[model samples]
Target: MSAMLEVVGLDTCYGRTQVLWDIGFSVAEGRTVALIGSNGAGKTTVLNTICGILRPRKGQVIFEGKPITDIPAHHLVGMGLVQVPEGRELFSRMTVMENLELAAYARRDGAVDKDIRGVLERFPVLGKRRLQISGTLSGGEQQMLAIARGLIARPRLLLLDEPSWGLAPMVIDAVFDTIKAIQAEGTTILLVEQNATQALAVADEAYVLEHGRIVLGGTAESVAMNDEVTRVYLGGFNPRGQ
Candidate 1:
């Protein structure tokens, strides 16, 4: 598959504090690419830079054969690059339905109503709680709402930052399953996750980031089987060896 988004030698910073250093990676069309790393390893910074929440001071961000390195965040959404941030940033005071409706702000066309219907259908729990304030929902439901909000924008390339951040094991499994369901519908995903095993399990390709640099990159299966990766990321279990 061809690359849908490419980050080449990216260098990003917040004021004088540099967070990302010469970062590079690509997400291929129709493929789920996983970026697994420890906390503060620049995983979220990569997504922020790509989405233009933070701009890169060096290198480029190429999307679907065009450069969008310094494009404004809103315009990037119009081009189908949507990001679901690390904290599941929802309008806490807004009702679930209202929060979802607000995601259409980036639409350049008239599919808002239809897209809203589609998102509600995909997440029936959100539909059931549509009238309730988003902040009142449980953690899993909040996560569902967050991803559903992103879907309402009809993104071609979805950037998810630490999607499994704070949830129960079962809830995390459900979230990953939802991600797989979304991917099956042809939306390419760039996923950053702290749950290395689960992230690598669902990924077509995986990259291990350390201190703001890619330490290892390969097919998911290969990376998972690596002795060091198994020790560090997979809790020291070589599943194949067991």
Candidate 2:
């Protein structure tokens, strides 16, 4: 598959506090690539830079062969690059269906309606609760709403940050299954996750970032089995977790 998104030497900051230091990674067409690290290791910052919430003071962000390093966030959305941030940010007062409708506003074409229908159909729970306010839903449902909302934009490359956060094992499993389903439908994904085991399980390739730098990368299995990773991210090489 061809490359859909690429970042070279990305450096991002917050005010005077520099967070990301010379980071770079890519997601190929139809592939799931994961960036896994402990909290505050710049995982979220990486997503922010890719989504244009934080502009990189250095380096390039190329999506679909177009340079979009400093482009406005809205323009990036129009280019089929959409992000589902951590914490499942949703319109609390809006119904599930209404929140999904917000994604259609960025469409450059007519697929938004179809995408909405597809998301609702894929997530019947959301369909059943379409009229229910997002804030009233359970944490799992809220996460679903967040992903569904991003899908409404018909994104070619979807950026997800810590998608499994604050959910039980069962709900996390459900979210992982949903992510796999979406990947099967040809959506390239850039995932940032703290759960190293699950991240390696679902991703085709993986990158390990430490202190805002790409420390290691390979087929998911390689990084998952790496000694350093087992020690830091997975707790020793005992193989208790798969």
Candidate 3:
């Protein structure tokens, strides 16, 4: 499959402090690619750069055969590159339906209501709480709303950052299951996750990041078996808890 998004020699910084160094990876069309590592490993930095939230000091971000390294973050959404950021980032005071509607602000289509219904159908919990304030929802529900909002934009490639953060194990399982369902629907994904075990289980390919650089890249299964990776990222346990 052709690559949907590719990052080459990416270097990003916050002021003079560089957060990423020569980072690179690609997400293939119709596949799930994961970037997994420990905290402060620059995993989120990579996603931010791809989403154009953080400008890369060097390197290129190629999406759909074109260089988007210089594009502004807001413009990328209309081009089908959408991000579900680390925090749910929901409008706390807005109704669930309102939050979803705002996500389509860049869209010119008149079928937004229909699209909203379609997306809400996938998360019946959100559908039930359509009129409630988003901030009032539980943690898992807020995350669901965040993802649902991203879908409202009709993304061709979804960048998911820490979808399971701060949730119960059961909720994390549900989140991963939802990700699989989304992928099966034909949307490619570039995921940044701290749960190496769960992330590898769902990813076809993965890159291991350490201190802002890619330290490992391979099929998820192979990376999972690496002694160092097992010790550092997987806590010496296999994906199935073996």
Candidate 4:
């Protein structure tokens, strides 16, 4: 499979303070890749840089084999690269349907309404609450809505930042289930999650980021079995059930 998204020698910063250093990885077409690390490990920064929310001081971001390192966030959205941020940044004042509609603002295709219906069917809870205010939904519902919104954009590579954050265990399971369903439908994903166990469970490839650099990269199974990853991220939980 070809690389759908590639980050080469990335260095990102907040003003004078650098947060990511020489970061590199690739998400292959139709595959899910996970980036796992502790808080402040610069995982989200990687996503932001790829989605064009932040300009990298050095390095290149290639999407579908094209250079998009300096592209603006909105333009990247139209080019089929979209990020579902960590915080579930919904339009708090808007209804579920309204928020979903706004996600397609960059899309010129006339299938917005059709896509909306499709996402609603995929997430039936959101379908029942279409008219309800997004802010009023439960934490899990909000996360679902966020993912659903990203899907509305028809992204070729989806950047998901902490999809399981702040949700109950069952809710986290549900979210992962949705992620698997989405991947099965052929949307390539680059997942950034502190929840290493779940992330490794669904990902084909895994990269471990530590203190702003990639400390390990390999198949998910190998990463899960590494001593440091098992101790620090997975809490000794064996993903392969050995």
Candidate 5:
């Protein structure tokens, strides 16, 4: 499969403090790629740069065979490169329906309402609370809404950052299940996650990031078997039990 998104030789900084160093990876069309790392490992920085929230000081972001390193965030959304950022970034006062509608702002199609209904139906909890303020929802519900909002944008490549952050284990399971369902529907995904076990389980390919650089890259099965990954990320629980 051809790459849907590529980050080649990426370098990003917040002022003079560089957060990413020659970071590179690619998400293939119709595949789920996981970028797993500890917090402060520049995982979110990578997503921000790809989605145009942060400008890379060097390197290129290629999407759909075009260089989009200079495109603004809003324009990228219209181009079908969407990010469900960390912290769920929902409009605090907006109703669930309102948040979903606002996500389709860049879209010029009449199907926004229809898409909203479809998304709400997929996330039935959100459907039941369609009129509720987003901030009032629980953490898992807010995460669902955040992803639902991203889906309403009709993304070709979805950059998911920490989808399971701060949720119960059961909720995390549900969230990963949702990720699998999204991939099964043929949407390409680039997942940046701290939950290595879950991320690798759901990903077809995986890269391990340490201190802002990619330290490992392979099929998710291989990454899961790495000693360091098992010790640090998987809590010494080897999936292979070797």
Candidate 6:
């Protein structure tokens, strides 16, 4: 399969303070790739650069082989690069239905209405709270709504930043399970997650970023088993204990 998304020597900055440094990765069509690292490791920065939230200083970001590093973030959604940012940043005052509708502003899917209903059907709890204030929903529901909002965009590559943050174990499981289901349905995923254990479980391939650069890259199994990962990333948890 051809690369659905590619980043080469990507570098970003916030008013002259450079953040990312020569970062690069590739996501094949319908594949799931995780950019795993702790805080300030340029994981989220990579997602921002890919989705056009932040323009790179010098590098190439190609989506379906078209350079899009200069595209506007709002317009990038139309290009099928949808990012579900951290914190499930939903319109708390808006109803769940409204949040989902807002996500489809750029797409003209023939079954848009049907698709909304399908989302509700698949997530019955969300359906039950369809008219409720999104901000009032439980943390898990809010996270689900965020993911559902992105799916409504009919994205080709879903860029998720720290999806499992501040979530309960059960909720994190739900999120990762949903991630796998999305991949099964042919949506390429670029995930930046802190939960290495779960992220490695769902990812086809994973990259480890540290101090604004990609230091280690490999398959999920390879990452989970690495000595560096075990010593620093795993936090000394025995597999049998888990």
List the candidates' TM-scores in order. Answer: 0.96, 0.94, 0.97, 0.98, 0.97, 0.95
User: For candidate 5, lDDT tens digit of each residue in 223-242?
Assistant: 99998999999999865444
For each candidate, the alpha-carbon lDDT, in order, equals: 0.90, 0.88, 0.92, 0.94, 0.92, 0.87
Point out where model 6 deviates above 4 Å.
Answer: 237-242
The residue pairs found clashing in candidate 2 are none
Over 4 Å off, model 1: 238-242
- lDDT, candidate 5, at 143: 97
Error of 5 at 38 (Å): 0.7
Instruction: Name model 2 segments beyond 4 Å from true.
Output: 237-242
Number of the predicted model whose TM-score against the real structure is largest: 4
For candidate 3, write residues 85-178 as lDDT tens digits.
9988999999999999899778999988898999899999999999999999999999999999999999999999999999999999999989
Predicted structure 4, TM vs. truth: 0.98
User: Which is the better candidate, 2 or 5, if ranked by lDDT?
Assistant: 5
* Error of model 5, residue 48, in angstroms: 0.5
Question: How do the residues 1-242 of candidate 2 rate in per-residue lDDT, one tens digit apiece?
Answer: 55899898998888888888888777899999999998889998998888888888899988989888879888888788999999988999999988988768766677777888889998999999999989999999999999998888878999999889999999999999999998999899998999887788889999998888899998888888888898898767523345
Question: RMSD, model 3, all Cα superposed?
Answer: 1.2
**In candidate 1, how many Å is residue 24 off?**
1.1
Q: Which 10 consecutive positions of candidate 2 have the poorest summed lDDT?
A: 233-242
Please report, as a residue range, the 10-residue window in candidate 6 with the lowest summed lDDT. Answer: 233-242
Q: What is the C-alpha RMSD of each candidate to the true structure, in Å?
A: 1.5, 1.8, 1.2, 0.8, 1.1, 1.9
